[model samples]
Target: MAAKPRVATCSLTGCFGCHMSLLDIDERIIDLIGLVDFDKSPIDDIKSFTGPVDVGIIEGGVSNDENVEVLRSFREHCGVLVAVGECALTGGVPSMRNLVPLKECLEEAYLKGPTLVGGAIPNDPEIPLLLDRVYPCHEVVRIDYMLPGCPPSADVLWTALAALLKGEEPKLGYELIKYD
Candidate 1:
C-alpha cells in the first residue's frame, strides 16, 4: 500500500476556533486519519516535525518572534503550506492591535488594566518578542493556499484537505466559503 500524505498544523496568535472546527468534522476524522498521517500537529500531540510533510496547515496570524520561527520552519519542511481561517489569511481580530501601538497594548494588559493587580510588563528571554503589528501568514512566508473564514466551516476544511491529498487544487463552492 502507498504511504499516506502527512499533514502538520499549528495555531499562532488567534483564538483556537479553527482547530475546533477541524474537530467538528466529527466521525469523518476517522476517514481523514485513513487518508493522511499527522506530523508536528497538536492533533497528534507531536511537538516537532519528524520529517518533511506533504501539507502544513497553519491557523492564526504571525504576532511574535516564535510564530515567525515556526512558520518559516513549516515553509522549509512542507511541500504545501496552507493558511486557514481569517487570522492566517488577514490577521483577523488580533490584527486590531495594529491600530494601537504595541507599547500601549502591553501597558494596558500588564500594568494598567482594570482587572490587573499591578504587574510589570514582561521582559524575559523565554517570552517571544512581539512584532510591531500582527501579520497574515502570507506576509511572513509563501503560502500555497488560504481559506478565509472566522473559523472556516468543517466542510471547507474537509474539501480543501481532500483535494490536496488527491493532488488537486481545492475548488470551494460558494456555499462553502463563508466569512463568519
Candidate 2:
C-alpha cells in the first residue's frame, strides 16, 4: 500500500476558530486520520515537527516574533503550506491595530486599559516581541493555498484537506464559502 500523506497545523495570532472548525468535522476525522499522519499539530498537541510534512495548514496572521519563527519553520518543513481563515489571508480582526501606532496599542493594552488597577507593559524576555503591525501569512512567506473565512466552515476545511491529500486543488463552490 502507498504511504499516507503527512500533515501538520498551527495557529498564530487569531482566535483559533479555524482549528475549532477542524474539530467540528467530528466523525470524518477518523477518515482523515486514515489518510494522513499528523505532525506538529495542536490536534495531537505535538510541539515540534518530527519530519517533513506533505501539507502544513496554518491559521491566523503573523503578529509577533514567535509567530514568525513558527511560520518560517512550517515553510521549511512542509512541501505545501496552506493559510486558513480571514486572519491568515488578510490579518482579519487583529488588523484593526494597523490603524493605530503600535506603541499606543501596547500602552492601551498593558498600561491604560479600563480593566486594570495597576499594570505595567510587559518587558520580559520570555514574551515574544510584537511586530509593528499584523501581517497576513502570504506577506511573510509563500502560501500554496488560502481559505478565506472568519473560520472556514468544517466542510470547506474537509474538502480542502481531502483534495490536497489526493494531490488535487481544492475547488470550493459558492455554497461552501461562509463568513459565519
Candidate 3:
C-alpha cells in the first residue's frame, strides 16, 4: 500500500476561528482523515513536528518576530504550504492596525489608560512585543497556495483538502464565506 500523505497545520497570530471552522466540515473530515495522516494539526494532540509532510496549512498572520520563525519552519518542513484564511493570505483584520505605531498602541493599552495596574511586563522572549505592522504568512515565507476568507466556508475547506490529498493543487478562486 502507498503511504498516506502527511499534513501539518498551525495558527500563528490571530483568532482561532479558522481552525474551528475546520470542524464545520462535519463528518466529511472523517473521509479526509482516511486520505491524509495529520502530523501536526493544532486541533490534534501533538508537539514539535519534524516530518516531511506533503502539505502544511497555516491559518494566521505574521504579527511578530516569532511568526517569522514559524513561517520559515513550516516552509522548511512541508513540501506544499497552504495559507488557509484571510489572516494567512492578506493578514485579515489583524493587519488593519498596521497603520498605528507600536509604542502608541502599547501605551493606549497599558500605561495612562484603562487596564488594571497600568502595566505588567512579561519576561518571556517568545512573547511578541508588537511591531509597527502585521504581515501575512506569505509575506514572511513562500506560500504554495492561499485561501482568503475571514474564516473560509466549510465547502471551500473540504474541497481544498480533498484536492490536496489527491495530489492536485486546490483552487481557492471562489468566495467561501456566504450562507443564505
Candidate 4:
C-alpha cells in the first residue's frame, strides 16, 4: 500500500490557540489522522525526530533566533509549508507590543517594580532579539499556504483542507471566507 502524506506542525511564540483549533477538528481530525501521518507536531507522541516532513504548519511570528531555526528547518523538511494564524501570518498580538522598546517591555515584565531580578533578557546573546515589526511567513521564506486570522475560523480551515485533500484549488486565488 502507498504511504499516507506526512504533516508536521509546531507553534512558535503564540498563544497556542491554533493547535487547539486543530484538536478541535473533532472527527475530521480522526479522519485526517488516517489520511496523513503526523511527524513532529508540538503534540507529538514522540519526543524528538529527524526525518523529512511533508507539510509544515507554523503558528506564530519569528521573534528570535530559535524562531529562525524553526522556520528554516520546517521549510527544509516540508514539501508544502503553511503558516497558520495571525501570529504566523503577521506576528499577531505579540508584535503589537513592538510599539514599545524591547528594554521597556523587558523592564515592564521583569526589571522594574514587581519584576524578576537577575533577569536573563530574551534578546541578549543567549537569547534572541525581535525585529522592529511583525511580518508574515512569506516575508521570511516561500510559503505554499497561508491561513490568516487572529485565529482563523474553523469553517474556513475545514473547507481549505477538504480542497487540499481532494487535490483541488484551496482558496488560493479566491476568497473562501470574508475578512474585515
Candidate 5:
C-alpha cells in the first residue's frame, strides 16, 4: 500500500468560512481521510507544522507579519501549496482597508470609536503588528493552485484536493466555480 498523502491547512486574516465550507463536504471527508492524512490544521487543533506535507491549503489574506511568516513556512514545507477562497487568492473584503491609511484605520477602532472607554492601539512586542495593506497569499509566496470564492463550495474543494493528490490538475465545472 502507498503512503497516504499528508495535507496541512491554515487560516490567516479572514473569517474561518473556508474551513467551514470544507466541513460541509460531509461524509465525503471519510473518503478523503482514507486517502490523505491531515497535519497542522485547526481541524486537528495542531498549532504548528510537525513535518513536511504533500499539500498545504491556506485560507485568508496576509495582513500581518505573522501571516507572511506562516505562509512562507507553508511554501517551504509543502510540495503543493493551494490558496483557498477569495481572501487567500485576492485578499477579499479585508482588502477594503487598503483604500484607507493604516494609521486612520487603527485610530477608528481604538481611539475614535464610540464604544471605547479607554482603549488604546496596542503596540506590545507580544502582539503581531499589522501590515500596511492586506495581501493575497500568492503575493507573499509562490502558490501552486488557487481556489477562488467568498468561501469555495465543498465540491470545489473536494475536487481540487482529489485531483492534486492524484498528481493531476483540478477540473472545475461552471457550477463549482463562483466569482462572488
Candidate 6:
C-alpha cells in the first residue's frame, strides 16, 4: 500500500476565517485525515515545514517581508500550491490599505489613532516590515489553484481537496464559488 499524500496549510495576512471554514467541514475532517497526512498546519500547530509537501493550502494575502519569504518557501517545497479564500486570491479586505499610503496607514494605526496616548510607529528589529501593498499569493509565488470566497465554504474546500487527491480537476459548481 502507498502512503497518504502530504498536505500542509499556512495563514499569512488575513483573519483566520478560512482555516475556521476548513474546520466547518466538521466531522468530515476525519475523512480528510484518512486521505491525506497533514504536515505543517495551524490545526497541527507545526511551526516549520518538515518535508516536501504534496499540497500547500495558503489562506491569506502577502502583506509583509515575512509573508513573502514564507510564500516563496511554500512554492519551493510544495508540488501543488493552492491559494484559498478571497484574501489569498485577491488580497481581499487587507488590500483596502492599498488605497492609502503605507506610511499614513501605519501612522493612523500606531501614532495618530485616538486609541493612543503616546504611541509611536513601532520600529523594532523583531517586527516584520510591512510591504507597500497587500498582494495575492500568486503575486508572491506561483499558485497551482485558487479557491475564491471571503472564506470558501466547507463544501468547496472538501470538493476541491477530494478531486485534487484523486488527481482530477476540481469541478466546482457555480454556487460553490463566490466573491464578496
Q: In lDDT terms, which candidate is top?
A: 1
Q: Where does candidate 6 have its weakest 10-residue lDDT segment? A: 114-123
lDDT of 5 at 89: 90
- lDDT of candidate 5 at residue 118, scale 0 to 100: 91
Tens-place lDDT digits, model 1, residues 72-110: 999999999999999999999999999999999999899
Task: For model 4, give the RMSD to the true fold.
Answer: 3.0
| Model 3 agreement with the true structure over 48-93: per-residue lDDT tens digits | 6757888898988988877887779889999999988888888888
The alpha-carbon lDDT assigned to residue 101 of candidate 1 equals 99
- Extract clashing residue pairs from model 1: none
TM-score of each: 0.97, 0.95, 0.90, 0.83, 0.97, 0.97
User: Residues 36-110, candidate 6, lDDT per residue (tens digit)?
Assistant: 998888999988899999999999999999999989988988999999999999999999999999999998998
Error at 173, model 6, angstroms: 1.1
Let me know the TM-score candidate 6 reaches against the reference structure. Answer: 0.97
**Candidates 2 and 4 compared by TM-score, better number:** 2
lDDT for position 17 in model 3: 84
Against the reference, the lDDT scores of all candidates come to: 0.94, 0.93, 0.80, 0.74, 0.93, 0.92
Q: What is the number of residue pairs that collide in model 1?
A: 0
- The weakest ten consecutive residues by lDDT in model 2 span 171-180
The segments of candidate 3 whose C-alpha lies over 4 angstroms from its true place after superposition are: 118-123, 173-180
